[model samples]
Target: MFTGIIEEKGEVVAIERTGGGALLSVRGPLVTSDARHGDSIAVNGVCLTVVTAERDVFTVDVIRESLDRSSLGTLTEGSAVNLERSVRADQRLGGHIVQGHVDGTATLLSREPGESWDDVRFSLPRPLARYVAEKGSIAIDGISLTVTTVDDESFGVSLIPTTLKLTTLGDRQVGDVVNIEVDVIAKYVERLVARQ
Candidate 1:
């Protein structure tokens, strides 16, 4: 589990592909400072296990399922990624509950940059539309953001300067793919209503 609060931005050092999986070597001193083998780290909205922990780099194996479902597969060496350590035992929920279990991907539709902030609109998947609402929480590329507005096919999120400077969303352009994880509570509500 994670809080969607990005601790630091990391860069992909190398990618080693296997038959059905790949091992990603990432450089993040902060997140890897205390990281040990088998620890969980959320990398660009995907929860990956640490297979090896070196000084400032760690390795995680990405399986075929996660690659097919997330934007991580498109990452290459030198690509910047949002990195967050797993939630601690007694920390406040600064952002929403981010399981790092990406449900699907959303494409950037448009970007409205303001003087101090930016409002980004993304194309919403039809099947996941009902799970999103205005003012609800959504995790995009491991960064928690609120839904500023919601339409049948799209939604908007306002990103502050801090977000724009820290995460990859700052450099995102229209048509770029981003991993999205909807609020878990909304999914539970939908499931309960469906059984009634």
Candidate 2:
């Protein structure tokens, strides 16, 4: 599990296609400093196991199913990605509980800049709409953000300068795809209600 707290921004150094999957090597000095084989790391909201670690880079194999569900499949060498290590057992949860299990992808619809921050609106998938509420939490590309507003088709989130600089949102443009993980608690609540 992760707290959706980004540790550092990493760059994809290589992506090799295998018979049934692909191997991704990312250069993240901070996250790789103590990373060992089999450690879990969140890459753009997708949890992947470390297959190999050397120097400032670590490699993970992405299976066909994960590729089909995330934007990671489209990444190429030199692409920048958000990276986060698993939260410690005793550390305070800086962000909400994030499983690093992306539910789906969302598209950047527009961005409105403010004096102190920017409000980014994203196109929400219909199936995930009900789980998102105004002021609720959502993980976008592994960064935890709050929903500023929500409607049937979209939701907006206000981003502070720190967030913009620390994560990939600073480079996002209209029509770009991003990984999204809705509040996991909401899904459990929905399941309980449905069985009633």
Candidate 3:
């Protein structure tokens, strides 16, 4: 599990294609400092296991299923990614509960810049629209943010200067794809109520 709080911004070093999947190598010194072969790292909101860990870089295999579900397939060498290691029991939940399971991808629709912040909007998938709400928490590319507004087809989030400077969202432009993970608790609640 992760808290959606980005530890650092990493760069994609290389991507090697295999028969049915691809091996992803990322340069994230902070996240790989104590990483091991089996440790989990959240890359752009997807929970991927470390296949190999070196000094400042680690590699993970991205299966075809994962490729179809999220934006990982669109990535290339030199792509900026949000990186966060799995949370420890002693660490505080700075953001929110994030399973690193991306529900789907959203396209950047527009961006409204403010004096000190920016309100960015993204096209929300129809199937996942009901799961999002105004003021609710949503993880965009592994960075936890509050939904500033929500409509039938889109949602917006306000980004502070810190977020604008630290995460990939800062450089995201209209039409760029981003991974989206809605609040997990909401899905659980929906499942329970459906059984009643």
Candidate 4:
């Protein structure tokens, strides 16, 4: 599990294609400092296991299913990604409970700049729309953000300067894809309510 708090902005170093998957190599000095072969790392909201860990870089295999579900498939060698290691048992939950399981991908619709912040709107997938609510939490590319507004087809989030400077959302442009993970608790509640 993760808290959706980005630890560092890592660059994609390499991607080697295999028969049914690709081996992803990312340069994340902070996240790889203590990483091991089996440690879990949240890469752009997807939980991937480390296949190999070196000094400042680690490699993980991205199966076809994961590539189809998230935006990681569009990544290239120099693509920048949000990186966060799995939360330790003793660490505080700075963001929220994030399973690193992306529900789907959302497209950037617009970005309205403010004096000190920016309100960005994204096209929410229809299937995931009901899971999102105004003022609710959502993980976008592994960074936890609050939904400022939501309509039937889209949602918006306000990004502070710190977020713009530290995460990939700062550089995202209209039409670009981002991995979206709705609040896990919301899904659980829906499931329980359905059973009643």
Q: RMSD, each candidate, Å?
A: 0.7, 0.8, 0.6, 0.7
Order the candidate numbers by lDDT, best to worst.
3, 1, 4, 2
Model 3, position 189, has a per-residue lDDT of 99
Q: Per-residue lDDT of 1-196 in model 2, one digit per residue for the tens? A: 9998899999999999997789999999999999999999999999999999899999999998788888988899999999998888999899999999899999999999999899999999999999999999999999999999999999999999999899998889999999999999999999999999
lDDT of 1 by residue, 66-177 (tens): 9999999999999999999999889998999999999999999999999999999999999989989999999999999999999999999999999999999999999999
Runs of candidate 2 with Cα error greater than 4 angstroms are none
lDDT of each: 0.96, 0.94, 0.96, 0.95
Candidate 3, residue 127: how far the Cα is off, in Å: 0.6
Q: Candidate 4's C-alpha lDDT?
A: 0.95
- For model 1, how many clashes? 0
Error of 3 at 95 (Å): 0.4
> Which candidate number would show the highest lDDT if scored against the true structure?
3
- Give the TM-score comparing model 2 with the true structure, all chains together: 0.98
Candidate 1 runs further than 4 Å off: none
**Residue pairs that clash (backbone atoms under 3 angstroms), model 2:** none
* Clash count per candidate: 0, 0, 0, 0
- Number of clashes in model 3? 0
Global Cα lDDT for candidate 2: 0.94
lDDT of 3 by residue, 40-68 (tens): 99999999999999999999999998899
Evaluated at residue 170, the lDDT of candidate 4 is 90
